[model samples]
Target chain A: MMELFFKPKSVAVIGASKNPKKDGNIIVNNIINSDFRGEIYPVNPAADEVLGKKAYASLDDIPGEVDLVVIIIPAQMCVQAMEDCARKGVKAVIIESMGFTETGAAGKKIQDRIEAIASKAGIRVMGPNCTGIVSRDIATTFFPIKDVPRGNVVMIGQSGLLAAGMASDIVVNQSLDIHKICSIGNKCDVNENDLLEYFGNDEQTKVIAMYLESIADGGNFVKIARKVTPKKPVILLNGGRSEAGAMAAMSHTGSIASNARIVDAAIRQTGCIRADDFTELKDFAKVFSTQPLPSGNGVAVVTAAGSVGVVVSDLCAEHGLALPRFGAQTIDALKGLFPDFMPPSNPVDLWFAIEKLGMTRALEAALGAPLRDPAVDAAIVLLAGFEYTMNAVEEKVVQRIAKECGKPVIICTLVGYNRLRNRIVEELGRDLPVFTSLISGVKALSKLCEYGIRRHRFGDR
Target chain B: MVEFRPTEIHGLPGFRRRFIRTFSGIPYIDVLSHADNPAMPDSGSENFKIADPPCIENEPMPLNEIVARARRENRTVLTEIESKQILAQAGIDCTETRLARTRAEAVSVSAAFGYPVVLKISSKDITHKSDAGGVKVNLKDAAEVEAAYDGITQSALQRFPRAQIEGISVQPMARPGIEIIMGMTRDRNFGPVLMFGLGGVLVEVLQDVAFGIVPLERSDAAEMIDEIRGKKLLDGYRGQDSVDRSRLENMLLKLSAFVDANPEIAEIDMNPVFARSDGATVVDARIILRELSEAESARPVQS
Candidate 1:
């Protein structure tokens, strides 16, 4: 049933327009641009053709069976369109029209009417005010998203614009390897549980990031998450965590478990990682999708400056990560790279080494040695984007060592020229997870290590 | 004042079989209808005779009967005695509490349990016993017990005139130990969630509590115990003896099991469970039932 939405063979766009500026036009254009090799039928009584495709008067006018329908019409007219879809035996529908429940009482009544129709017909509805889905296989969102990478990460959100905006940013910047981004607004029928369960069993999905204003069914969410998280990491960013936000959630969904503590408990019990903000949501997914899970929580901080290493050490401790002492061989190897005055330790400060042996050699001995150490499960390598560091980025030294050691590594870049930093982000960021702040990098690595240790304890490969 | 006939027990739906199995030898199975007692009958001379100490080992508690009676009567709140009975049946330890219907019965019950007993007015209507001056703790002798009983009855009658006063619940004074609170509450979305925390100031002022969704695994129980901010206090703070952590974990697991088995229960509160070095004992308990919908009433109960 879920596959029909993501991999639909034929699709019909209700209220699809020929005008370039309209959402109906964008929806049709997005599907036309993507890898979706399905039949497209644009339903607009006023137009004979839409986006070079023949437009139909209604869903009944379409020739073949419609597997999926993307409705972008007015809110009041949605009941009629839904009835038409139900009569057409359309199993999947994404209602991108706004002015439903989120508006007021009259809107809620209309939504309820649409829900009754969908339920009676045994048809699944995604949203009443949402941008549907963006993936390599199909792009149903009104946002101009194209060339979506078939990455292993899947993002599920409740806000329509945020999910579409983030998808645009990620795709345009090529920051995170994303498989699909699903925005379920005013979740009338298809909820996080349905999508989560579907993606949990998906062979291609490795990490799932979710942003929910309210959970439709928490009991089922915990049950499914308990099973899915043990196999793959599920990162969650709860929107209504504060008192004010909880009040907002009540008005948004008509009901919510307003207690933040219980929500936190559910997250910890299911082993799903909790992300505090949007950046962590994206950053954690980036790290989990690209890097290998560490065997333990032991992290060796490899930094050019001592102060940054100290700050990272504190952050690591705060995030339940340990900065353990280096092993004898690792310490001995790092000592040879350091000057006489500075003794090598867990942080493995690399300013002297970088000045003496240049960027590549310093990283090879300083970052590479600890990464291969038996005592350290992961490493946080801090880099300052400078002219000298440009060589290492070009050589892919950090990326090479992280891949070779078969352990997780996160790089934090700070205090550098914009051009050099942009170069670093563009060059090394494509293959490795890079953060502008130490806390984000450390936090991401900590989540990966936490999941890794849990997996290792459960004897999962 | 209502004379309950033994033959009426046979009329209860699904109660005849279990009632016969549990109370076969016991004479005079007084079956009080919901009209007589809104919540449950008084402890001394009522249905399901109160064991002297109230801790009857291996005695199969009639959970279905109590729940059905409450639902039949349209009562949402279960009396404290009823709550303890349900908890005890789940294999969790609680202080032995028995009902005394009269002054003489209260004195005798306290004497049998030993001196320094606690007497609390056992009525479903009086949720705040202390506020209503219905609680008299640490009575040293029969004379004090007699006086306390009269005072409680008068004060409760004066406070809540229409309350269906069941009787006085008498239990031995539990030894001083670490005060812990553990219970379950139904979330709007999540079915039932269990909570663990320190009692008194730690919980009241600081609000330091940890929660877990129902059907918790043993590992989840351990994590919830360790998640609280005052978790270190559980490990023998100052000169106090370290609480039996495994025992606390077991109680939590048992509660999770009980909540999982019984979906009709809407909420439960077991506050001030004394966690001693040897074990933990629930001193007070409250269980609220979800209003019986047509679907829930028609569904077969899981034993």
Candidate 2:
């Protein structure tokens, strides 16, 4: 059912226009620019051709069968378009129009009529106000996105910000390795549960990050999440979790149990990792999709300065991560890298080592030894954004050692030159998870360790 | 010691009267038999039946009947006795409580259950018993029980003039221990959820509670117990005896099971449950029933 939306063979743009600024034009252009090999038909009464594709006056005029339809018509005309799609025997439709339930009662009535029509025709509607889907194979969003990398992470959102704003940013900046982004606004027919179940079974999808203002069906969500979480990680960011949000939920659902507390209970019960903000949602996905899961919550903090290491240790403890003592062999191995006056410890301070052997060799011994220790399940390498750190970033010293150790490693770089910092973020961060702050780095690593420990305790399903 | 047998009455076949021996080293029967009562009735046994002490061997009353009876009477709130009966049926332990319609019944029931005992107003209309002066605890003798019963009835009537007084409920005083609370409430999205926390100031002021969704696995229950900020207090603070944590977890699991089995229950509150080293006992309980819609009432029951 979901494949009809993502991998449709042939598609029709209901309101495709010749004007370059219109959403109708952008939708057609995005599809044409994507890797999609399917046929495209533009249904417009005014234009004879859209982006050089033959235009049809209506569904009846199209000669070939339409697998999916992307509707950009007025909200008032959505019901008529849905009726036309039903007559054409099209099973999937993405209505990217505005003025649905989010407006008021009058808009709600029109949405209800469309919902009735879709249900009767056995059709699945994606949205009444949204930017439908963005992926390497197809892009239906109004935003201009191209060359989407075939990455492993799949994002399911209930708002257009994910597909339009975030998708363009991530693709242009190459910040995240994203496979697909879906925005199901108003959720007239399709919802988060449908996409969760679909992506849960998707072989290419390794991590799922979701942002929802309200759950469509919480009971079904819990049931499906319990089954999917043991197999893969589901990171969620709930939009309306405040007391004011509870009031809005009361008007939406006409019930009292819509508070943040109950939603949190369901998340914990299903073992889904809860993200406090949008940054955590995306950052957690970046780390989980790239790094290996640790077997325990034990972490080793490796830093050049003692102050930053102390802060990292405190943040790790606050996140339920333990900084275990290094074993004798690992300690002995690290001692050889340190100078005579300085002794190696859990944080494995590398100031003297860096001063003696430079950044590349010091990190190779100091960071590599603890990562190889049996007591440490993960490592947090704190790097300063100075000219000295350029050698390590260029040599990929952290990346090489992290790969060899086979343990999860995150780098937090602060107090650095902007040029040097951007260089690290663009270079090392592309492969390994790198954060500008210690809290975010430690927090992301903690989520990985937590999930890993849970999986280790309860055998993988 | 007296051995009592089940007495066959006109229609009540399982009628029986059992003597309760006081663990507090006080003789209740002699005091009740000698106490003077001007308003006492000659035949107390005919009007009230002493509820049996809660034990594993006792046959649990049907839960649906308790819920249906409350709904039939146009009441959403179940009396404390009814709530305890429902909890006990779910395999959770609760202090035995019985309804006494008159002063004489209250005395005899308290005597049978032994002293010191607690008397609470059992009316559906009265929810805050202590606020309405409808509660009196630690009554050690018939003289104190008689005085406490009069004080409770008069105060409740003065407070809630039109309330329907269903007589006071008498139960043996539970020994002091760690105060724990466990409950279930229906969520609009997530069906039902269970909560566990320390009872007194921790829950009231700090709101130190952890919740788990219904139909919880054993691991979920264990996690809820371990998630609270005051969880370390459960392991014995200072010289106080630590509570039996496994027993508390079992009670939470049973609560989840009960909520899962009974969908009509809207909310349940078991507050100030006494948690001892050996076991935990629910000191007070309240269960609220969901108002059935017309379509829900018309649906056929599943076997």
Candidate 3:
């Protein structure tokens, strides 16, 4: 059923326009830009052409049968567009327009009318107001033209901006080869469960991230999420936490927002990692996608900065994440790498080593040094490519330490070198996810540790 | 071994007979669970400020006034919904409820919300209306509800003799939540001592209770909730989600606060506050309102 969306043979951009600023422009541009191999039609009569393709006056005029219709026309005209698409026998109409149900009584009336029309026609409409779906298999992105994502992590969300933002940050900023990003705005018809089920079966998609304002059709999402999370981590971020936000959520997505406390209980009961913010959603999505699930919660922080290290320690301790007491054999292994008097601690600070013995020993101590402590189940190394840390040996040392440590070793650096950052992910491979920000890196590690704790208490399931 | 001076019960000949007669069960067997007239110490600590220990404590009022008050509120017994509403003002969680002004409306509502919904005549006047046939349970459909409502109304009139018949209560038969009981009645000796216990059917039968003073914190409330043997269920044993314990703990704290705030309340009983996978919601509640007199006004309740 989901293959129809990803592998549609022909698609019609019903409200497709040449205006670069219009929502239709982005949808058309996204398709033109992607590697999607499908017949595309620009259906607008005002101009005989759109994006160099001959424009059809209406769905009735389109030369080929349209499997999907992307509509961004006015609300009054939307019902007509649906009728025309139905007459033309379009199987789906992706409405990228807003101003219905969400806008109170008048909007609800308009939306009810549209629902009736679509139901009569038997057309599976994605939304009356939504960002059309975007994917590697499809060139259709309803996001503002610029924010296209490419990665193995597929994010399905209620808020268009949230999905668009995730796509922008993951693809453009992180430079990840995201497999697909679907902005399921408003979720008038398709919801988290549908997309999650689709992602669960999608071979290309290795990880799933979702933002939900509410879950419709009961607890099916929870059951499916529980089943799929162990296969590949399903990172969840739920909005409507506050009372006012919850009430607003009902209008935002036709759901009761059904008492946030219940949502919280249900989510925890299902065993998905709950993300606190979008950064963690993306960060954890990437990390869990590539890294092996750690077997324990004990973590070792190796950093050049004392303030950052101590704060990380406090965060870990508060969250029940242990900074394990070092093992003797591990300490003995670390002694040779460290300067005199700087034997070994869980943090195993590298500031002193770099000051005296130089960058090579410091880098070795920073990366190669952390794994030596057997107490450390996982290691988080904080590095800022400053003058002392700029030596060419740092990346090489990190590479070796990560290779030796069977557990995850996440590299946290503020600076980005396209080649260096890309090289770390390539060399380290699935063992770790090198992050751009300290906050995200720390959060990912916390979730990894949380996953370990949950696994220990509840087994693999 | 260091020991204190012996008391009279300890030294008297046939001390066993006296102890058995004082604290024992039906045949006067010296059993702890059967303790009726509690050894005075069990009532409370010397410094613990309570009006009295758990007993039939009510303000002195003529039967006429009690009936009048019950009639004024249009109830047979102090109705469960009315009693709970009073508690909700002080931050208590009760089932979402609506009052029906007509019997037809009540019957229809009961049917819509599904069977097994609790139905009772609500009144601020009568205290034990359930005993007076003013309460009914688990009605299947509209006809049964209409019959039950009429039955309860007639019974209230027969028993109260003066209750001003208010509209009947049509409530969704309470969903199951972890059951806990909380109450406070003004005591003769100490003051208002709070009561906590194993709620539901166990409350009436087992009589398992733990008492504490008002205004409990999370720790104190948690301890009070766990004072009974059946509390192990809340700890998540044998493949069940942990009972909504955090909410249950809050209910305890709120109960203490409500009793402490309302000076007119002579007694308050919120029994079987059922908690489930979601949270604890109050199922049934009863409260006794005190009448103020100039003579009694010589001393207002403890500030």
Candidate 4:
């Protein structure tokens, strides 16, 4: 059903522009720039041609059957343009124009008219005030984000700018691959449950993250989410958490629960994770998409600094993960790698091991020992990958061990500078996510463990 | 030497005397004589049966008709007696209630129920009887009962001069036990959701409640009970006897079923439901029916 919107055979840009500054031009340019194997028809009344393509005056003037229509005109003209698209038998329409219900009562009247017309014609509408969609196959976003990596995480939300910003960040940082990003602005006709059902069944989507100002129908959302989350996980971050925000949410959308606790309990009962903010949402999405969920709550802290281990131990307790007492065999295995004066413990601090042996050997033994232990469900390796400390660091070996252990291995770095951080990310973050701090690393692992434990109880393989 | 807590044998003497006084057919001579050797385990902890109330066969009322009448009269909140009757008809236990119009009727009802009894002004216009000073508890004698009857009626009449007076209701005082609340409120999106929490004044101060959508299974009830922060208060706190959790779970299940069967019920507040080891009793209940929507009223009739 979503293929009509995403993988259209032909798309007609209703309001194409010749100037590069215009949103119309950027949208057409993005579609032409990406690896979209589809026909593009630019329609502009004033221009005969746009961006090296023959421009038609209207969607009716398009020569062949247009599968999807992209409208970026003024809000006043959107209803007539929608009528023209519906007459042309376009199955999907994405109205990228602003000034819908967000403006005031007058704009809301116009939006309601558009909805009635679109529903009567049986044409699916994406948004009236949105950036449209950014998919791996076809990109129609007006934003200037380039080369979003094609992978298995779909982000669909009400905020277009937030999705655009995160898309650009994920693509630039190479944190996680993006299969599809949609800004479901206003949700005049197409809402979250429709898109959730679509992506929940999409084979390309492994995990879904949403930023909901308010759910259109919370009970219906839970019903659909309960069915989808068993096979794939859904992480939602509700925005209207404060009293003022709750009041604002009433104007934004109609279905946010008055009590935040009710919404929280609903999310929990549906077997989905509720993230606190945008950063946690992105963090959870990255870890859930990249790492295999830990089978238990026992985490092994393998760090270079003992203070890092202590802080992380406290965080583990706070997050409901535990640092188990190492068995004698595991202890002996770690003791063999470290010096006699520095005995091995659950944390398996690598200070003396690196001082006596080299950095590469000490890291390899310290990281490998805990990952191989049966008692440890997950491992967090803290590396101070500075210029001098990581002179002989082997990222391939670390990544290979992480993959071979069959459990999740997350790496945190103490290297503060962006230049060195980029290098560390380039090396280790390719296979495993390299968190910037121990707190983030612990938080992600704890979430991973939470999913694993809940999956066991929910009995969803 | 072992020192037993004073609360270990609370109400025991009175309970034995009541048992002997009430039931003459049962043999109590041997059981009373063997009080010294209380270690006898011929029967498996039958003394716990003291908490069980006598079962009564209740005739189900015309709830649908009652709801329709309330809607016709444009009433949203049901009186406490009406709410408890609906609940009792649905198989949940409630205190025995009788409307007393005159002071002599109140006295006789109290004497029949074996005082001390409770009296409350019963009127459709008054939702908060206690707040209006329309409630009196522990009316120990005929003079006290007459005074309470007049006092509650006068206070209620003063609070709302135009309100119709339905006199006062005489009820047997419920036994002391754990106070817990079980209620249902209709959400705008989700139809009806059940709420459970610590009852009485602490319900507001603690704010320790858990909610679950109605039509709950046994597992959901158990989970809702366990999720509340005051769970330990019900599970025998500080050497006090624990209320039966199975009974509480059953009450939750029954309430869920009741809400599921009655869609017209907009809100049901069964606050201060005295939960005991044997069963739970609804001391006060309030059911608010959904108002008829404007759309329905505006629709043209076929006739």
Sorting all predicted structures by DockQ, with the top scorer first, yields 1, 2, 4, 3
**DockQ of candidate 2 compared with the true complex:** 0.22
Model 2 agreement with the true structure over B97-213: per-residue lDDT tens digits? 887655666788888889999998877777667878888999999989888877887776667654555568899999877888787777766777787888742445666778888
Better of 2 and 4 by DockQ: 2
| lDDT of every model, 2 decimals | 0.83, 0.82, 0.63, 0.75
lDDT per residue (tens digit) for residues B54-78 in model 1? 2222233478867876765557788
The candidates' interface RMSDs, in order, read 7.7, 6.5, 20.7, 7.9
Say which candidate scores most in DockQ.
1
State the lDDT at A78 in candidate 1: 96
Compose the digit string of candidate 4's lDDT tens values, residues B95-119: 9776555566677778888999999
What lDDT tens digits, residue by residue, belong to model 3 across residues B30-146?
222334522222111111112111111112223344334444433233456556656666678776444443456566567667776777766544555567787787787888876
| TM-score, candidate number 2 | 0.88
Candidate closer to the true structure by lDDT (higher is better), 2 or 3:
2
> Model 2's CAPRI class?
incorrect
Better DockQ candidate (2, 3) = 2
Candidate DockQ scores, in order? 0.25, 0.22, 0.03, 0.10
* TM-score of predicted structure 4, chain A: 0.94
Query: What are the models' TM-scores?
Result: 0.86, 0.88, 0.60, 0.84
Residue pairs clashing in model 4 are: none
